[model samples]
Target: MARYVKISSLGPAPCVIEAGGSAEEAVERMIAHWKRMLGFVLPDKPDLIVMPEACDRPSKAHYPKEERLEYYRVRGNRIRDYFASVAAEHGCYIVYPTHMQAEDGSWRNTAQFIDRQGKLMGAYHKNHLVPAEYDANGILYGKDAPIFECDFGRVAAAICFDLNFDELRLQYVRAKPDLIVFPSMYHGALMQNYWAYSCRSHFVGAVAGLPSSVLNPLGETVAQSTNYYPYITATVNMDCAVLHIDENGRQFAAIKRKYGPKVKIHDPGLLGSVLISSEADDLSVRDIIAEYGLEPLDDYFNRSLAHRCAPGHMEP
Candidate 1:
């Protein structure tokens, strides 16, 4: 087995339902749009796919504030079902970010995750809602940060404006999931990279009207959607580990020499870092790290900090 996971992200090419259109028409349009975008990814055969926030409907940029607020309350379930059906057909994990009505009849910004078998894994509500989400949509904020367990690795999610706050970021740092699916209306390339590097996790962003990208733990963009096409896919080896290149260069080489075709190393040569993964199904980078006595870069830095001493007063 490759033990490698492929991720796909879609930047919204929206299908707007005209105001006053029949609800059936809206459902039809939503399903067709999702199918079209998802079909573009079947050829690539990604293990997971993410679509931008509110990709089911057009932006409220043209709708009056009041009408936009009430829109999702009536149609949220229908839109969600259309997405869920598509996820079932694809047989891959899908992050379908959209507006959802909570039990109290309150609307929430939620990223709903459907597992490979088309089961609803759970929904991660947007903990930090943008001002408009509250003032215009009267959206209620979520209180919990949930991390879902998956076959490849643990998966987590954060909504558009949720990226701006440290609350969610700190939670992710503590939880330390292998992957974070971020669905956003706004494009914040730098903040996304910050979250990825800080949490030591791979991040895939589905941004509306902009390029969607897959970023590695090193904050390097490994794949991105182009303007010509709204989606992109990349395969990531989850059996990888991050280590300090300067300190472990010799050990890394030795592992490569020993493992040969069983391991692959990806060094960007820019951050004194490298991503090393196992190729054979029975083995993983963990085995190599254990053998070489190589410590994770974070642990190495923490240990180094303990040895930090004030500079000698020769210059002082």
Candidate 2:
């Protein structure tokens, strides 16, 4: 079986890059900790990897078009160059997203999946951009959710807020991905609740990647070491359990019936808002316990499902 690694990481901003430590430092930290902590118990080296968004610190010098493309071109190239170098050194695959401008002025947060040989295997551009990212009118929003294929399994990306949309996730799920990755930069007072909700609800037996940090009003904890700031990288095995199919063919009717009233559900809009909505897949929680034993899967599910999401529209 091809082994895969899901990376949940906090992004390194342009400021971090200027202070003697570039975004490469954050990548190194994630790689080092991933190997040191998770790799210690793994049977073999991971064959594929996934990372959160904003891997490249986008700046005018590096991200502008025409006169600016040159700057962004060089910086963008660094992201790939570094991954290739590290993949060669570690003998592992690395997947990440870069800021790419489409024909128009808008940006496409394109996810690039690379093999251990440093070859570019697949790419997917983000389709959902938040309204807060827009100007006064709230007209601009991202518009695509593409899934890609890899040697190990099918790979797909849902940048941060994208996971909040059930319709989008379901569209990806219907395709039956072996692994789905979500990289988010969600930071707010209630993020603790939101992050927990997203990981537990949408991701089952499938890894949900995150790299988050809390910025204090005061600069008190800003300079703390790795101990003060940490990230979560969880590995979920998709092949271990099966979805429950009732005699009448109701897969997950119990949970659906329970939460249907409270949670507004809808289809991903083809011509409406970018926020997608739908029900989570019909995964068998009991069967997961039976196969993997109740300890791990139970603990994971019991974590909670209260991640904060924006208001979703009802199905038309």
Candidate 3:
């Protein structure tokens, strides 16, 4: 059984994540919560660590995108070092996912996951960024989903915004990872529905996206909390779920085939690979990337806000 823990917690300090606050203090708070929530720290310190978005206070936007990106990169490294030191102290591998950061000055948003040895393991750049933010332009928006390797098993990540797109999840699924973690900022009743639907619909065994609660590989609600700030954990056994396949080496599913004659649902899950062919002309490569861009990442960021504002585009 694979153990996946999801926690709904608060930031360490008021201004650390925002700017002009102590990042060390924020990390300390996060560590304390981890120890208290998980009962005991990892023996090998687990291969991957998953964390919610924006846990740290962000820096003010006076600096240009390049400078801002550098600032976050440096700060992210510091924060990871802090977490890694703790993971090493306790003995476990960690894949910490924080708010997206852009390095190389190319305007790409990324999720950095480090291992127990305090080495940068792998990163998942936001192929799908939120549109409103200025950083959504150029190299940041058009990209593919990449999964990282870990000691326990292959792992992939879904940012808070990535979770809403079945396409992103389908892309991660193609990686055939043993686990997929989503670190999000959403809560309340709506999250309640997503929590349940994500398990039953998306991940067959591994947790869908992390939030206040966690679901098991079997899509079962293993644990939850009544408090406003909550954390939950469950063990995942990768060998459990079967990856459906046909004789032609194609995974089989008909959900999209069942759509209306003019509309087709592309089940990226049934087919391996983030880029898949579909009969649906409406769904294009650009559309997929636009929906999942990283820098401006948000749950509903990709939806057509423009069309909604202009009623003329609405069909009768």
lDDT of each: 0.80, 0.43, 0.44
Is 1 or 2 the stronger prediction by lDDT?
1
lDDT of candidate 3 over 1-316, digit per residue (tens): 2223222222121122333334454455445544554343243234344555544424234224454444554565566676677556655555555555455655444556666576677777655556644444353563666766666566666655555566776565445565565554543334333433333222211122233444433344444443443433344333223221222122222323443332222223533212122234455323323333311111232344665668677677
Where model 1 places Cα greater than 4 Å from the true spot, the runs are: 62-74, 309-316
Supply the global lDDT for candidate 2.
Answer: 0.43
Angstrom error of the Cα, residue 222, model 1: value is 1.1
Q: Rank the candidates by TM-score, best first.
A: 1, 3, 2
Provide the clashing-pair count of each candidate structure.
0, 14, 35
Q: Estimate each model's TM-score.
A: 0.91, 0.50, 0.53
Worst 10 residues of 2 by lDDT: 216-225
Q: Write the per-residue lDDT of candidate 2 for residues 1-316, one digit (tens) a residue.
A: 1132333333333212222334445445434543543333223445544444655443333333343344454454655776676666666667666666555656666677777777777666656666654453232455665656655456556665665667666676455554455555553324333332232222311112223432111111111113333343333322222211222123234534654632222212231211111223443333423433333322333432322232453333
Scored by TM-score, the top model is: 1
At residue 119, candidate 2 shows an lDDT of 74
Tens-digit lDDT string for candidate 1 (82-192): 666766777788888877667787887888888888788888888988777789767888999889888889988988888999988999988989999999888886999
